[model samples]
Target: MLDKNVNLEGKNILVTGAAGFIGSNLVLELLKTLKSVNIVGIDSVNDYYDVKIKEWRLEELEKEAKTHKDSTWKFVKGNIADRGLIDSIFAKFKPAVVVNLAAQAGVRYSIINPDAYIEANIIGFYNILEACRHSYDNGEKGVEHLVYASSSSVYGTNKKVPYSTDDKVDNPVSLYAATKKSNELMAHAYSKLYNIPSTGLRFFTVYGPAGRPDMAYFGFTNKLIKGENIQIFNYGNCKRDFTYVDDIVEGIKHVMQSAPARKNGEDGLPIPPYAVYNIGNSNPENLLDFVTILQEELVRAEVLPRDYDFELHKKLVPMQQGDVPVTYADTTALERNFGFKPSTDLRTGLRKFAEWYKEFYKV
Candidate 1:
């Protein structure tokens, strides 16, 4: 079980993108478990979605700080691509574990604004690596683990039902997927050369309260609220492994302790201290089924009327370019290693999201 109490006393943790959905949740859990462990959370808090939501997440951090005054929870509002800013943070806090979740996250948006992905996903990640490289004095307990967020989008139309880390990820259809794949590759090289134990987590369709509004579920909700037709891509035939945000955080918390290691090189020699895992719900749900449940939950939560017109309010559109047919994650390795898998039913997770959306939007 991932709920086991793990002590991270005295470990200074650094979380980038701490304003984002999964990042904010992970920060909360870390504060809850590790008593007074210093955390330096960095987020650019750009207008990726509504900046107000990011502000709300920062407010959560503020609340956490008030509760644990001695926890040393600090937030730095700046872009990670700024080398001077990142280096200064590294010199000041000297975090022991670095979680990189800051990235320009959006598949369709990437096609429109590819430069944003390059700056944030590539350049920003490079600055983080460099900062980590300089953190240690003669390699004495600098960074114990460097965990980063990858995406199932890297699967790129893989014929396999459940994609694994061992699967070939060379065919990234979108620039966003390419950047995530590039992050894994870059982490491998840095881990091999600098001995920075790094782990990459491939998150699949994370959703719940305080989730990304840009995702399909949230977008559907927005469209439904205005009595607009919701576009069902691929004629509502796609299936996805929609892992809840809390479950994703739990997986990350469990993985924080299980750091990667160098492989035994040439009969007891060491390979790069890098690994990747898919943190996803094993149960894949159809897109239409997910929407139906979401709509039902909205009605239950009173966000939508008991008899809101859903029949004529749906448009079956063709799949967008760079869109995959389905996204499924093979969690056999994740279960075997972490002894945990995301088990939240799509209804259960989406219901919570519907409730939150209703409240947040005051609909």
Candidate 2:
């Protein structure tokens, strides 16, 4: 409960992965809401999904930057795993708040390439922690808050209905999940040792317009438009807490304003100022139901014809390796603390994605 507050006005904020889906949306909101703020964004611009979507997000950020009278935006194309690059950025910006959203993102991809997860999610996050540590040199009040992304996948194969922060996340089913859990552990250590006020957000299934094309909703739309069959894993029996990207961004924005307070133990050592919360839609939707809504939305947006044979184009298959049957988040902690919960329904989120897909692809 380190009670630290950041004034976005006249402050420098650094957002890693700023060109990514949630990062870009966050930048736009900051530029729109706060005045006299300087935002520095860095991303590797990797072709994990489509570089075009990242570029499009950056384009939208630039548009918002131009319209703001007092807010400024800077984009640096680089990887967070590079210690020198991360250090240099911190040295130059001396940002009061650091949001580390950059990481190797997919579970299935991690199975194909486990090294990427270690390099980006683990090593990259280590570099971020190191930079935050050094930011406090010379008694400077550096990095009032260090907010980073965690994942609901950390609660691997839990029989629990609603995954909670209080649950033990020792079992990780994927390399990606392992790396994310490692991040929370590492952040806790850093917060304990260096007294870094840190918050880790475990995000559930995030989807929205201009979202990652690898996501099921976006990929389904793409495949359906091309008349290619879309595979529904686990015979379409899985459930997920499909949180809208905007809701995720909103949660991050609210969390950034407050940092854990440093408290001293009886021995006079500062207790670790660390916190973690689940940011997700409380309602879990079945995979088949989610796809059904996606199909309807696709037709409504004219991405698919009204008579499109969704059944014929959907292939029910066994669950892939490194995947869980469900991801239902308990957002009670986030709501209790931040007075906010993700309320965006799956249909509303998928509809926006469908509309964006049609417009972006000119389908």
Candidate 3:
């Protein structure tokens, strides 16, 4: 395993999308793990799903912060797309590690709201790159590592069993996928030009308690709770590498400590200092089976009645416009470099979600 180069303890770290599912979890993990660390978070807290959920996450962070007396937490309510605000935060915080997780996330939503994708995914990311590039001014130690979120959607509909980082991702099937692909390209350019050590993580279908409501597992739960039919896309043939939120956060924490080493090639210039990796379970679960597990978990958690008619609430439907058949991740490189891989099984992960949902919704 590659040796860790950046130590997170006693450092100022900036995490965008602070109120988000993955972001909030990451922040909590950092506070719990590191002593004497300062974290600055930024989020628009838009009403994309439920603002109350976002607020609840922030409240959790507040509670977590109280226990870690040596650590400091500051949150800014704003958008990363706002250049002035982003620049000001970077200038003030001067974070040693920057994690960018703010973006328009849904594939289907991107179909109708392409502008949000471009504005947040494209322009917002560009602003981040610019800020990172400028952070090294006056021979100051700038961002040691820049880690951002990418999606498995970048693979499109490749027939390959397991997607690899070395595989071609030039063909993106959805606008959301295209934007994520664009983020990889933009980061690569900044890394090459400014010698920023940047890493992009291609996450599979990430789900858990307090997750994004637009995701299949969460959405299906909501619809089933209300007695509405939940559509099983691709006629129940679709498969996904459903990764748990805690596993994803663990991978991120590992990556944050180890940035790509900066070195000069034969040309006497920087070697881009860039890398990308896939963080997934490497085990794909069929949609129908996934739904069945989710249903059983809900019943076990008392979120749904044991006698609820699940058959009446599930509908098999054709593939949506911006969806792929399957997504499997090849995590060989991740394990080789970090000695870590996501191992959370569907039943275990779904059980946590069901329990959390039961408590959160007062079922």
Candidate 4:
């Protein structure tokens, strides 16, 4: 395993998209793990799905911060696309580690609202790259590592069984996928030009308690709760490497401590100090089986009645635009380098979500 080159304890860290599902869970993990660490978070808290969920996440963060007396948490309500705001935050906090999780995240929504994807995914990410590039001014010790979120959508419709980082991702089927691919390219350019140590994580279908509502698992739960039919896309033939949110956060925490090693090439210039990895369960579950497990878990959690007619609430539908048949991750490199891999079973993960949903919505 690679030696951890960066230590997070007693350091200033910035996490964008603080109120988000993965972002909030990450902040809580950092707070629980590190002492005397100061964290600055930024999120627009837009009403993309539900603002109350974002607000609840921030409230949980507040509670977590109070428990960890030595750690500090400061949240800024704004957008990362705001260049002035981003510059000022970097100047003020001077964070040693920056984690960028803010972006327009839905594949289907991207088709309907392409502008949102360009504005947040493209322009917002560009602003982040520019901020990281300028952080090293005046010979100051700028950002030691930059970790950002990428998606498995970048894999597109490749027939490969398991997607690997070394595989070419030049063909993106959706605008969302295209924008994420763009993020990887932009980070590579910044890393080569300014020598920023950056790593991009291609996450599979991440799901768990307090997750994004747009996700299939969560959306299915919502629809079932209201007796509405949940559409099963690809006629139940689609498969996904559904990863648990906690597992994803654990992968991120490990990556944060180990940035790509910076070195000079034969040409006496930087070697781009860049890397990318896939964090996923590696085991793809068929969509129909996934829904079955979700339904059983919902019943077990008392979120749904045991006698509820699940057959009446599920509808098999054709594949939607911007969707691929399967997504499987090849995590050999991640385990070889970090000695970690996601192992959470789907039933256990879905059970947690069902229980959390029951309590959160007072069902």
TM-score for all predictions? 0.96, 0.98, 0.99, 0.99
Better of 2 and 4 by TM-score: 4
- Indicate the TM-score of model 3: 0.99
Residue by residue across 196-229, what tens digits does model 3's lDDT show? 9999999999999999999999999999999999
lDDT of each: 0.88, 0.91, 0.96, 0.96
Off by over 4 Å in 3: none
Q: Clashing pairs in model 2?
A: 1-261, 2-260, 2-261, 2-262, 3-261
Q: Rank the candidates by lDDT, best first.
A: 3, 4, 2, 1
Q: Compose the digit string of candidate 4's lDDT tens values, residues 1-363.
A: 988999999999999999999999999999998977999999999989999999999999999999987899999999998999999999999999999999989999998999989988999999999999999999989999999999999999998779999999999999999999999999999999999999999999999999999999999999999999999999999999999999999999999999999999999999999999999999999999999999999999999999999999889999999999999999999999999999999999999999999999999
Q: What is the C-alpha RMSD of each candidate to the true structure, in Å?
A: 2.1, 1.2, 0.6, 0.6
lDDT of 1 at 160: 81
Model 1, stretches more than 4 Å misplaced?
A: 1-7, 267-269
* Number of the candidate with higher lDDT, 1 or 2: 2
